[model samples]
Target: MGEVLVLTAAAGVPDAAAAGVAGRATRLAPGAIEVALDRPLPAGFAVPGVDANVVPAERRRKRLLIADMDSTIIGVECIDELADFAGVKAEVAAITERAMRGELDFEAALDARVALLAGLPESVLGECYAERVRLNPGARTLVRTMAALGAETALISGGFSYFTGRVAADAGFARNQANTLLVEGGRLTGRVARPILGRAAKLAALEAITAERGIGVADAIAVGDGANDLDMVRAAGIGVAYHAKPALAAEADARLEHSDLTALLALQGIAADAWVD
Candidate 1:
């Protein structure tokens, strides 16, 4: 079907209007706006208070979505909770805070934190996954909406694959990718495998997923909440930082400080009431 796409110019970096095209213009970012309409837009039309340009909507791609797990899809930090299980919540949380804030080196800090959990029994991993992890509000609605729209979804995390795998299963993701926690004799070995998944790994996952799906980067949307997520979010057509760290929120293509994951549905022309949870 013919349609109109209102996009922002890379140079202009326009702001969103108080009300979107249909009613209120939702701000996707400093330079992006999401327009909702029942039909194709008239030529040269512009929504008042919103800088809109009309383009063929069919040209827009609709496949490949990459998302981060901890803090993005789920409300809690799986590793920190695992620390609590290991009786080192205070120490581990300190390092986690620094890493999330981009103050300490991520790879090194991750190693130190995991080392603290060295003697932790493998069973605590399941305890943390079961007792601590909860899906972020509206996460199911967001992922289901994307799948219904024909987008292939994947969950990538800097956290361990054990947890990411469970989250992916519960959240309807097509695949899951994450770091593996080294284990020996039913306890953490205090070390992670080489080529740890950090900023570059996250971005590379986006590229790999898109290529495997035969889709362009512009067709994908990536979401996350830490310094490590910056590269992936920036590379996708729509990169959202949901309740992210301050630095991440500042750089993301879209910021969701006040809303849940459901806010993303608006970007794809799905209204809140119409959203399927």
Candidate 2:
């Protein structure tokens, strides 16, 4: 009755037994294996191209999902894409990199980037969404499949609400939250609404939602790819760093580098056939 180590690959199931790990290996899906372990994972134990996670088997599946939208669920960072429309992509993207890496304060970075887009046309938001925004592979399946199983789903972001609202619908999240971009005279007002949704806000959303659902914080799974997502990710029962920056990856309970979002389901012992389209 020890913990289980979940090994998930992007293709075929990895052979944990063959890797010299001592355990009873169980295949959960085509590309997933669970190894029951009585002791800590041996030093340097790894399988090429496979992401591994060790957790109590009893807490494998979560009842709530709190996900960061930009660069985690979506392929592009919304602010960076919006900056492109404002002719400041290079400038803004640099700050974004630093912020995601935990080198810069998230709120300050957001303020500087939005300030650079002060005069951009409001219509440019639509242009960026149409031209640059896209759901990363397996995003919809991950959200919809979890929702199908009666779990609550929320998309929260440090990015603006405009993109989160649209992405949440496309990805089938039950609700969404993000900072509001202030607009005036058909152009950006060079400011976000007060009380910006930064790292602290993301953590608060996780707390509020879980409380509203009458579930413990440990009943949630939080996923993201930035430093802004660290708080809630660390607090959740399962915290995943999805193709993340090094800062987040270092602290995540599970890291998905080679596989897609469906791998999260695999970690939860859900097979591919049960996924919702």
Query: What's the lDDT for all of these models?
Result: 0.75, 0.89
Worst 10 residues of 1 by lDDT: 9-18
lDDT of 2 by residue, 138-158 (tens): 899999999999999999999
Any runs in candidate 1 off by more than 4 Å, and if so which?
1-62, 272-274
Instruction: Please report how far candidate 1 places residue 188 from its true position, in Å.
Output: 1.1
Q: What is the TM-score of each candidate against the true structure?
A: 0.80, 0.95
Worst 10 residues of 2 by lDDT: 12-21
How many residue pairs clash (N, CA or C atoms closer than 3 angstroms) in each of the candidate models, in the order given? Answer: 4, 0
Q: Per-residue alpha-carbon lDDT of model 1 for 1-277, expressed as tens digits?
A: 5543444423333544323344334455443556545555555555443334333345344477688999999988888898888889999998988888889888998899989889888988888888889898778877877887788988999999999899998888878898999999999898899889988899998998888888888888788998888889888877777778986877876666655666565445454455566
Query: Scored by Cα lDDT, where does model 1 land?
Result: 0.75
